[model samples]
Target: MHSPTLASIPPEVLTDNILLRLPLRDLIAISACDKYLAILCNSDALWQRKLRLDYDFTVPRDRPLENVSLKTVYQRIGSPRLFVWKCEHITHPVPSHRDFCELKVDRRVVSLVATHSAFYALDDEGKLYAWGEKVHWRRLLTYKFPFGSEVLPVHIKLPTPIRAISCGSIWITAIDTFSHVWFIPDWKQAYRIVNPMLEQLSSEAQVAQVESGWRFIAILTRSGELHVVQPRSGIPNPGQNLELNGSIIWNTPLRLATMPPLPNLPAINVGEEEALSPKLVKIAASEATIIGLTDQGHVLQLSIPVAVGESILFEALECGKIQWEYLPFLSEVEKVRTDPMYSPPETEFEKMDPWTQHVTRFSRVFGRCPPPPYGFLQMPPRIVPTPPCILKISEIFISDNDICAYSTGPSSTILIGSTGMRASDRAEVFPAHQNRPVAHFARTEHTAAFLTPQGKIMGWERTARGKYADEPSMMTIPDSTKGWLFLSITAAGCHFSGLAIEWEELDADTTNAYESASEDEGDD
Candidate 1:
């Protein structure tokens, strides 16, 4: 007898054993083979299995996904996942046809963040995935992982489900569901929990968010508390001290001091201590400053001073090895006594005013030079306070040295900080024509992109002088992405990657076949 044709075999058998195992590309290609095969291949069960196997995604159990076929689910949650486009600089001799290449993430990503050197994604399962330049991956893995050399995206093992993640130039901070914060300083050190200051606040109140600066960390808790950790000194010079060269020491996380009341806000009533506490709702940080958003929608700013000239003293104090009060008493008495007639005559301690002598002793103890002689020239330390912006900002983005703020009420975008010496200069608000309510925003060193609620992306390029284009223009979405929903966009290493989703619609023939198959199954 002639062997039964493969197509004649029961559809159920082919779907369960064969089509369910096919990869996404192969399935899409074979769907055009025949009506019977197309219908079977698009079955909810077969696509669902493919999704689970390939991307580890599950249709929400609580949602009515039964009416949707697995093919539709795959299109919505799988095929349009990650789209990457390389900039002309990164991809020299650009491709003849400029287009975005799909990066198969192989998972359902819910959130993503990227830096110039690294890209990170958090999947629906709360697992962290990282991919980027091999050099960076190596530096980030250093002595921590045996497989630190991997350049492709790989699942990072963590102690718990990640709720939020933030990355700086080289370090990463992950907040788990339990509100515990884990920090990865670099590739050489193993991940460790933040100090008890963070741990205690996290336990008492849920950590609403976490953010990272080049050398600082900021955390915002549900209780309206803002905590920041920063370095006590500027970048270390290895030539001066090998032990401290390249070493990064973070200060203990400390609650930010209460902010002064907003100009128009009413004064607090007597006996209302809680009113003094700023109810911080969100926070963002730059290399040396932290910006906070209050419940009343005011923006507050604070700077973390990096000790420059007398860093050794600052380091000693930061490490708790020296106390400020003790330094005054420990000043060198012999030096003043021995140098009595060197230049200006030195006054005996008993003859000097107590307060003036105390100040002089304190300065000497901390290694700070006394005021230069009246005629001598001296440069004063540059100390510019970050003036708090009165605008009601809904989101803030800090890239390199530029600060951008988006206001929801006015639907406007403002660029703060000038390119030159005046970084805290007045902000330049974009023209009203370019203003729109931004739903998502991302930036790299020289480019910033914003996604509007209407599903449009607008981008601004920084000029050579460090100013953004006066007006932003709409970004071109690839033709292939016509029907997809853009979720988020991020830039890293001269490339912009966008997360998108597409929904598949059932054709007339496929829909009829599906209905007929349902009837046959009921009859059986």
Candidate 2:
């Protein structure tokens, strides 16, 4: 029976082994063991001192914002990929850790509007989130003739555990704590917001079915078509009806008669064969392009030309430009370069091979690398490819867990940053891994900037290979990109917030910092 106190421990012990680390739970337990340990652990700055032993706060805090993890402003999403693009000059760079904000959903976000795009999620203490934005279209919610024909809206209870929501263009869909399926029309209960041009939906259009594992919800009809719907409300509305609450935003019938399975294909999965009705899906976006990843490592870039039928294998998706159709699948990274449409001007070979996205897609391409083809061309000049007519992104970038693209614009440019510097470079719409040129960024053609915590701006030159770039000079930006920022994350998992310096002089800053570090070295 003893009452221990902080006075017992020697002062020298506190400073000894400053870098030693103890398990967090064990430290808490040790503090609770007796009164003496408790006081010492609770000292003015003891916890921070102990924290420093195991963690490097300086490194973490000083990490550039642009270099943080592949997170996003909307942390509620899972696997957030940062994207930055300019129309005048293409300068999209693959974001490291600093780009993304952490998004952790209590559950997964899986909302499939059509084959082109499905929804993923992220979360920050349930305070923020961002879902997929599909093409926007309106379904007629209410169409009653003013004279006499009454258009009664079908009634449904408001959803619960839902927050904010949106729908895809060809198919209006939404997501919440639990995602839903709806054929959205422009009718309103005053409280429920619908797309203004909403078309009337069919009865079996927008019902949400709780998917297995509670990972996501499915938007399908009583028949075999799929679409996405809005999510449920996080806050519950006790006893509200349609007029008092909202009309059921549901879907219009999508009659798609695809081919049946071809003879060469293996027998259908045992599980799929047993299902009452096969869960078949096809996605279509209004104008925005979407890529679909199947469980088998298959990738399909979506367009709106329907294939013959369900009989076509997953790899056979090739057709025209429609709002909704199969996203043409790519067998090799090289295949991503071929023009899916017949337009010759639109064709460029796939040079920037995106890494495997095992988290989202089930594709055969994973772990498989293809040799260079016979006609494969070497790296070309950093000329920005002709922008797509619809302003859709022709290229996508994937670095580690992050992906980005130069999807649109009247311009083209990309910006990349390092701790001591930032660089703005032109993005060759078609950059291959081997032939990719760092010289492309030297022109500042599109003018991108990298920001830092110390209010520093680092300009960059696209170099073939070198620790320091020798050309194009540096840029300085005084104003931050404001609230929104481009984050950079390092391979070591360090994060750095980036601000665009309105004006940056590389010769001045780099020379100073370099000289200072050199002097310090000489002092030793």
Candidate 3:
């Protein structure tokens, strides 16, 4: 009899004991040598394990969609690109593409958030990884974690997996899979909030979302209630010395309280009747304000009345003085139906107020160029009727003075406004993105990025010490991408994070094998 060969081994034993132990790169190399091995290597069970191990992703209870396979999902999230500006003061060449903190995460980054000097990423396994100034400064100056220099990302320790995470200027807030809230005052360890109200709230209702702004955190419950929490350690205390940085000397414990209902509610018109009140479904925050979205599409703005460099007073919060204000917006109908024409006024000073006339005269004398023959005649403002166009706001994003409102649809209508913009105030509509719809967008203190449907990223940024770019420009994908297509983009501080999948066009044979694996397996 011929000597027994490796091919005589049972396929199950070969896959489980031998092939599963090989690294992904090595496995793919070996699979190309034999057609039989290739079929076995592309098995659903094999790729499923690869997805879980390499990307920390698990398929939902729902079956895979037709023509798509687990292997495709695994390949799509494998490419994670990061670009950072080593010299934030320079603007010549774009920020160079580099490994995240010079170390590869390997796992897929599902959520990423940034503070001014730090970036926090949450992998699919709920593991929190942090890198940037916080990690480097602590290790070098304070010798906090001597080994952290090589580690790059300091994997935070927690009791349970974090389902979601948000970062403020100094604090990182997280909601665990169990619906418990955790605060990471420092980057290394996480401590769960032990307030009686929070404990009771968790048991009564699930946490729908958590958002962090500056040093304050807001928790939204599924029941539509909102709770604000300010950690004493991170917030500036007014009672302390005024000259200090304000956040370092606080000694009071964490202050947690419920937000008062909106004092000024906007009515949403139904078919024939108008609903006076609607429940808040989402929220976004900046340093001094919180923007809330109602289920009926009305936008509410709440100004957290805290002095510059001072913390919120808990007593005033309970008193209900801080309330949500109704924010009016231009509706799509008004944008299309009405046209505001700007023409030379009847007279040079027709619509010009006293202050405007003074400014125009001042500009002519001290201006770089001579003023127009008519000087600057202000355009007459058009008055929108009572009950201003209340837009159906589907979502909102806030970063400092910039606020972005997105309407419902795959191709959303985006309106860019500021924190305190009024109904009559004109909002910016991006002319560059008019033809290409945006799929994702994120903003840090100085940077804004938008991702298109076709794996393209475009944005503008103000360097830490440089001026903001006048127009958005397309970002160059790193050569390392090879055949990967970016699917998501996010920014924190001066750096950006992107997640990509392998393009199907890169390997037609592999793509076909993935889709026909079931049929091939049955034939064997």
Candidate 4:
């Protein structure tokens, strides 16, 4: 009975029971002190379990690249911090600055989608957390009301691990790992969307992505097929007179649940003689239209059935009257390929802030293989290049009538375009963001937020009379935590949320000095 000394405990118990259960900070501390504990803590199995538990990082079956370890992967992700802010409204109370409230989560956030009533964040391991007005809904008398004004984030359990989610005004559409489509009419429950076409299509090709607008849902398959449908079952109709945030009437009766592919997509030239249909890799939806991006760097738009007081007519759309239309560039892409003065823009790897660099490295190490914000490439194929800049649509953002195209080329500007595709072939570039290359962009109906490569946020919000401000304003965090860097931003209606990481003041100063010296060298 030697008083059960610390060294007497079995190695298995220490590794499985004690070490695995310890917090990261405590584990790191113990690992630094003991050589045996350090070896156990740095094991691939241990770190992979930790990553899956905290960040939803699924370890691939293939061995990682040389010199990469699970311990390094864990360190690269860092800890995620969430911040929220918005102008005050009568029903939803929010702070104008991000300092007054802190949103705590156990794991790292993978994506964020919001509606006017609530905010939802999906963590790395497929755990969904929700906050805001609609987290807890109660029916008092004839009308349903939210339980609280500003609810804190809470874990939401589902039948399976969800990979992607899109939000409507009051509902959410999600795709799980099994390739099954789920519609959440209420935040508390989810129903599997039962359709023969979806079942057949899913069997043939997996559902890679999903997007939801005010009334329509867009499904993109792994084989590059796009389908649009209006969800009718499991949807609680709020009646004809009760208006929701994004309530609108369809031009046809609500009987259209069929998934019809976009007819006659234009083919692109891959070589001198070979041509093929542009494989749609990304899609964005608004109230009245759906925007599509092909793997070849073409942007196409199609109008959906939206009306003031009529129902949607499926028969009208089936007659081949409405089809996808290409949004043409001002000059032919072939011309830029032959220009003598054109030089490719240098990659901005050196200009990225420390937090961005960490994310990029982590993505590469884990074989994630996609740029931040979304899985789109930094540059599209060369066939769709723009003049002088040699730009292609790297990302697209849309809400209501405002849509913007983000390009990655010599002049990486966030080019704003309207939903009206026929208005002009030339996109109206944002004056405030002409020179600033953004790493992320988030837009609501009245607000536009841009995150620079240096982790600074610039926003252009609607004025008092409902027009955009001429000059963009710097979005600042609290003075006490001035050195924090933002990783992502999202907005819906009027509310905004950001994910950031803390950096010490001294380390931040040193990093800024390094960045300044690098910029001077580039200038020289």
Candidate 5:
């Protein structure tokens, strides 16, 4: 008897047992075999198994499995997503594309963050991986660490799974599932827990979020408290002048004493200052600034004052003396209104000086002395405009000197200080796509990417003169990859990187065989 072909096998058996065991790449190839086989290959059960095996995706119990499509689940959970770095080594190496040959990592990455010389990734299993310059890699590895070279990625497994990760110019911060925070300073040999206070606080109340600045780390606890930490090299003494090595050594987590109270929240205790005691819902940090969002949706900003010619390294050691300032635009407006310089000119001649009254009467008769032609009276002092008010911010991303904030309601993006333009004038600088909301936004030292609601990637880069070229252009994948669904995109230094999933289509021979097999099975 002739051997039964794949098309002649029962669809239920092939789908339930045989096809589910094949790899994702083979399943893609098999989907082209025919109409009926294509349907079986694309079934929910098959894709669900593929997702669990390939990507370690676990469907949430709260979701209704019957109503959700397998394709949707795959895109949302199974697809690989990562942050790509566009550094000099990755974008423009001396030998041209040589870095691509060295850019090989064995694990599947879920998220990544990179600086100028180093790149770090968190795998699906929450393991940390590092690869970059030899000096940087050696700094992160312990004396007994196995890796001897930085050319290959090295895996570092922590005691617990990492929940969040952030990178600064030369530092890294990660939070574990148990809410413990770890810090890695520039040129450090190993990561360390933030402090005993943070450890105790984390155990009591989980750390909801963590952010890194150029020289500082901001931690927000679930109890609504905000704490800031800075790395110091030597023991912190009262009056000793210490030199810094540009490496951070977090000593203790300090509760910021200047956090403003949220609107409609209960007043703080009798001795506790309102500014020091509001529960923060979210927090974000830039080079020297921190922005906090209260549960009541109030936006609060605090920044470290940098003196002229002061280095960030020195400031890192002096974090204890830094004071947080509240950014109240309304109060600033009131102060400006009360200033004597902004007061309207006096109309009553009785209050004017004798010389001013004489000059005014002469001007009233002689067509107003053409205002002093020169000197002090030539022009009034220029009035400084109020800072732009940013309300209802959904998310914010900061890189180098650029700050990008996404607002709700209209779903518009706000770019600040990226192009050296005033914040008020920058409202129209970023490109606008009608009705398409941005799902993700990221930036490097020079370029930025925006992922839209329709799964399209839009990107823009700074020109040689350091100005944003008109608007963003559509980003496309490589020609070699066909029928791939683009998931996320990021830009760094000079190159663009993205994550995508492959999709397959049915072919003619498979379609004919599937039809013939169906007809024959019906006759039997």
Candidate 6:
């Protein structure tokens, strides 16, 4: 095994020369020597060198996401889903909204991390909202006393507004007032679950990544080495004076590895060999529990151990089964190979003729689709040629078709102007045409603020089932920009993929009055 004797009288060893240069699985065992050894393990210079030597680490800040907003929301439109905020003459790199379907930022951003819980969004200032709740919230609420007599408090707030947080499935790491760190279980708020009393743990620890699963927390020191600590065992009360250093209590951690890339949510795919209609195609991966970040800025994937849950090697050693396993639940879904699965089955396929519409021969990327019925589309009498200045958008809803148009931003009412249906595929496409929006509804809880050329930032709210206002919803930018106004529709699930923008000249009376007020302020 080529093991070296530590008693050989060598005063010290350079990391590259002796330790970090060793294989990662070997490094963890060796670093358990002391806190000084722990600091050495957390060295990035060592990690970077190891990364370059082993994995395809050349992503100079990987940015498949930048195709939308830049890295920081403050520096740019942090998400591809947002409209880059632009002032009259100033181009803001940061946009107020990423996607039209973006969760409305009522104010305040909080992070929630706990054992066996999916990350949740908390606006302590507003409604308790959640996204990516693949895991149940109720389970987390009763973290400490999970089962009996403990009637857990429905609402639990940290001593202070939690600015940032992270979890390790069973444990929670949070930063609060004065930047002090604290942790607890889901049941801690209901019952006070304190730390395991490890004195060796530094009081000044800063935990990061409240948004990722297998939640990671890094303790950064002024010297820059990052130390990671594991949750303690739920053993019975310890003696008054238990020495903690070299206590053999810490669980050995795994190092960062170059994992697989996540797959994209299904997008619209149509071509010669095949054609399909657009609907809700969920973008998930079989490769589950891939840790990622989501908040204000960077989306860097932090390296963490794969499934080091209860069955950890230490526990397995205490019992038997080393519980480390990869999360393969999400990545194993029976991928709908094509859209046909959503339609009817074999022999009886002809029955689907009445409900769906299929486009033939037009091969163009979304948005600026080529002048319809031109060379691209074969125009089998099944095709309809939309005029020039007009854009053929993805039908808002395949069930009831409506192509939303926009001028500036979404208005109080999106002129669902084109309600008269056309049917080449269906002889009964539109018999109940009243020549107006098939439906007139009000904008409900959804909100979007679009800046007008007149320098007015107009806020809009969507009208939907007062019922769905209670459901998880997102927003989208409207591509309805025309001459002087912008319009679009929003219901439970509308997305803003390609919203068209237009410059409008609002009435002079309002513009002049605002100008006069501005001039008065300038004189003052």
lDDT of 2 by residue, 171-212 (tens): 333433333323222222213233322222223233322121
Which lDDT values do the candidates have, in the order given?
A: 0.54, 0.28, 0.58, 0.59, 0.52, 0.28
Give all TM-scores, in the order shown: 0.55, 0.30, 0.62, 0.60, 0.55, 0.26
Per-residue CA lDDT of candidate 3, range 1-524, in tens?
99986578898888878887876656766788888889888887787776666565554222322245666666556555443432232233333343223335766676666554655777877888876556432333232212113436767777677877877655677888778787667764455665666777767647888887764678888877888777644444345534322122232243433433443334444542234446777888877777887666656676775573444454555666666666554234354223222222466665575446666777878884444445544433322222224345566778657777765323445556788666466655543223234566666555666666555566666544333444467665434445545555556444565655555553787656654653454456
Better of 3 and 5 by lDDT: 3
| Candidates 2 and 6, the one with greater TM-score | 2
Model 3, which residues run further than 4 Å from truth?
Answer: 1-71, 78-103, 135-151, 233-277, 308-312, 330-391, 408-411, 420-436, 444-447, 461-472, 504-524
Which regions of candidate 6 deviate over 4 angstroms? 1-119, 122-155, 167-173, 178-202, 205-312, 315-524
Poorly placed runs, candidate 4 (over 4 Å): 1-54, 57-73, 76-78, 87-100, 135-150, 200-205, 233-276, 308-312, 329-388, 408-410, 423-426, 462-473, 505-524
Q: What C-alpha lDDT does candidate 4 achieve relative to the native structure?
A: 0.59
Better of 3 and 4 by TM-score: 3
Clashing pairs for predicted structure model 5, backbone only: 33-510, 34-510, 34-511, 231-249
Local accuracy of candidate 1 as per-residue lDDT tens digits, 147-265: 11324676677656776788776577878767876665553322434566776766775788888765556777787766555532333333453332233323353535444545333
Tens digit per residue, CA lDDT, model 5, 472-498:
665543223555444555443344455
**Per-model root-mean-square deviation over C-alphas:** 20.5, 20.3, 11.9, 17.0, 14.9, 21.8
Residue-level lDDT tens digits of model 6 in 405-488: 211111111212112222111111111111112121212123323222221233333333211111112222335333321122
Candidate 2's TM-score reads 0.30
Candidate 1: Cα lDDT at 310 = 42
Question: Across residues 284-328, which tens digit of lDDT does each residue of candidate 4 receive?
Answer: 887767777766566677776565222333445555556677665
The TM-score obtained by model 6 is 0.26
State in Å the error of residue 237, model 6. 12
